[model samples]
Target chain A: MSDLSVDLGFLKLKNPILAASGTFGYGLEFEPFLDLNRLGGFVVKGLYYGPREGNPPPRLVETPSGLINAIGLQGIGVEAFIAKVLPKLQALDTAVIVNVCGASEEEYVRVVEALDAEEGIAACEINISCPNVNKDGACPAFSPESTRAVVREVKRASRRPVIVKLSPNVTNIVEIALAAQEAGADAIALVNTFLAMAIDVETRRPKLGNVLGGLSGPAIKPIALRMVYQVASRVKVPVIGMGGIWSGADVLEFMIAGARAVQVGTANLVDPDACLRILGEVEDFCRRKGIERLEDIIATVKT
Target chain B: MFKDPEARIVGKESWGDYFLLTFDSPAVSALARPGQFLMIKVSDEPYPLLRRPLGIHSRKDKTLGVFFKVAGIGTALLARKTPGETLDLLGPLGKGFNIDPCLAGKPVLAVGGGRGIAPLYFLAWELRALGASIKILYGGRTQADLPLADKLRAEGFDFACSTDDGTVGRRGLVTELMEDEIKAGGGSPPALVCACGPDPMLQAVALIARDKRLPAELSLESRMGCGFGACWGCVQRIRRDGKAEWIKICEDGPVFPAESVVWEKESP
Candidate 1:
């Protein structure tokens, strides 16, 4: 049998597959389908400083091979999550990574400091892709310079390993990956959902309530792979690649493109046991190739 | 709770733009209740990737019925599927109706308009077994939209229908028909009203249920990613204790009390 264990520089995972944020809900929601412990890790929904009602209704709509969503980070605040949800998630055998989002750098620090003192947090995936809110004569730091600033502040406040989730909306992803590495991010996870929209011809209106939404599914997989390959080859830190990843073959493709680990997002919506099934396929591929370790495929892109 | 079960189609019926896909799924049928939905994989094709959410229309013995309209690519794919072909599905998901036994003697009004009437078919059957009298008041844009009147009557359900253009039945809205019934009441309001339909119709139904001081449950709709509560994709606004709160249409409900829904705001 091949070893699937992955040490993401700072945080260690038994395997490389983890449920992407928002799509998987809390770990308990999928308990009826599969044992949560069977997967390598699970990231809870994006946690913010205050409780958000999220974007208005019609926040999601089905596209050809993707889901367009503008669920603007609706969630239970950090305090409630720590009190009600954290204990149960902590009991699970898999690594529990909290996906944290904020409107500003100060807000990010507040959430990070709170989680920093908490137990059982394997890491924090900083969602820099969240629509940045800046009024101080500056654009939000998803830009290379801006990203370095937030990553530095968040890295100092967070006790757990920090994985800066990169948005694909940026012009040059490699520059941002390098910026995160320079700011001392433990790892980088690319690429967040691509911003896209669909229109309702009959209504003469956009399908989503927010007008624009982040697109995820098999439709975005190729773009995600290309971004992962570009950033992974350039950055020194480990890269956690995710964007419409569905199967074990997709995982291998990401790994071959230099992704140290992967997070499954939209595929979980189609099948709850997607992580387990993909793991099975990965193991099957490993067995067939006589490959002994998962790390062997990292950046081993045949192309 | 079988994970992903392959449902063998036992029957298929074509009614205008609607299609009834009945599958031999004993495990799902045994657990299905009114208001719950099943996510059916349309095909192995990658374009229309997500499974479509069809409300369980009827479940007899080992067979479960899914009545749907060909809305877009996903449902059109489902419409082409034939009997004897197995479909991959995840089932009996979300909170169904809370039909209490105390309301058995009272009449249960099942309201549906157009393709929204699909799930109400199964709900009528279940309500009958529970000893609750069933009255179906379905409406459609035209005569062609009214598909369930005959089936409901054949099952001995007290079925009536209305059409906007007055093609058949009453020449008015189904909500108007319901208002007349409420005005022509016996002693108290009928047990409870369970409804599924377009948002505007449901909003009118909510208003009717509210004015009559009757208990009402609405089978809501939204864009669903994973029908199993994972994506948190489908959400609608509902009032709890005079305060408005947002709830997942896929998780918290595809059904909620009529008054609980804040019909003032448009739902996705």
Candidate 2:
């Protein structure tokens, strides 16, 4: 059997397939369907400084090969996550990472501080790409400078490794990735949903309650791959690539594009078993290619 | 917990605008309980990236039945499926009706509106086999929508129906038909009321259950992302123990105690 394990510098994974945050809830809900210990690891839904009620109803819309949602990062806050969720997640045999979102720089650092001393958390995936909530009407991930500032602060405060979740909405994503890497980010998770919107011509109403949402699915795969290639080539830190990854080939493509590991996002929504299934498919591909380990092909791209 | 397995289509039957799909899926069928649902991948294509949630209609041995209406691109694709074609389905997800907690010698009241009546058929069928008294109240916008009327009658079920246009059964809301049934029972109704349908109608029924202090349960619907608890995209405001919490409709329930639902914040 081909070795699917990979050491991502800051974190070691049994495999390279991690369930994306927001798509995996707090990780307990999928205990029935998902054997958490069997996979690489799972990231829980994004958390905030306080409980967020989220956007109004009709927060989701489906596009051709994609889904756009404005869930607005509704979470139980950092404290509650540590109290009610972490204890159980700590028992899992896989990585238990928390995706934290904030409305401001201070909010972001505060959450990092809370998780810094917390136990069982493998790392903190600082979210700055949420389209639902913006501070001063600007999404932090949109500006490379803002992205660097937030990552630097969180990296300084965080006891564990920090992964700065980047946005696909930016024009020059490479610059943003470089900024985060220079700011002391241990790693970077690319393409946190593309900013998009849908409309209902019949009622002339926006499909999502928050008007716009992050678009993810097969529709964004090509775009995400391009961005991953761009950022991975420029940034020194390990890259966590995610976007419309539905197949084993897609996972392999992301890794060859220079991602140390990949997160299965929208595919999990289509099939909760997508992660494991994709992992199986990856193993099959590696076996057929006569490759012994994923590291052999990890970012081994050719002209 | 859920499983994604390829289920072969056994048959497809149409009742007006509704399509009743039967799949020869033993595992999902065996695990089936009324009020439980499955996420059906309508097509192999990528455009409609998410699965459509459909409640189980029947489980005759290893065959599973799903009754649904064509409401969007996903359902439209589902309606086009032919017998012998295979479908990838993830199911028997979500918390179904906890009938055991309320079954104690009390009869069951199953209320539904249009396709909302779909899941209730299986629910009533189960209770009937247990020798429990079952009364079904099926409602719709008009006669064209109440196609399940004759089928419910043919099953030897106690049927009470209403149509908004007064073209069939009683005229007015389903809550009125339920009130009439309650009056016919001499003010002592069934032990439990289980309902499914559009939000407005379910809310109205929930209000009646509240006013009468009748123990009721409802199968709620929301535009779902993942038909599991992960996304928390399909959430409903519910009041429990005097506190309000947003419960994921796909996980916490497609079925919840009727009184627990708070229709005030209808949008969230």
> Distance (Å) between predicted and true CA of B142, model 2?
2.9
Model 2, stretches more than 4 Å misplaced? A135-137, B100-107, B264-268
DockQ of each: 0.68, 0.68
Query: Cα RMSD for candidate 1?
Result: 2.4
TM-score of chain A of 2: 0.97
- What is candidate 2's lDDT per residue for B1-268, written digit by digit as tens? 4575679998889976789989888878888899999989987867677788999999898998999888888899989999999888888988898767447456778889889988898998888876778999988889988877888899899898899999999998887898888778875677888999998889878887787788889999777888877787888888999998777898789999988888854522
Q: In model 1 chain A, where is the ten-residue run with the lowest total lDDT?
A: A132-141
- Share of real interface contacts recovered by each model? 0.71, 0.78
lDDT of 1 by residue, A79-119 (tens): 99898999888888999999888778899899999898889
Pull out the clashing pairs in model 1. A141-A146, B57-B122
Mind giving the per-residue lDDT tens digits that candidate 1 earns over B44-115?
755687888888888888988888888888888888989888898988888888879886777888889898
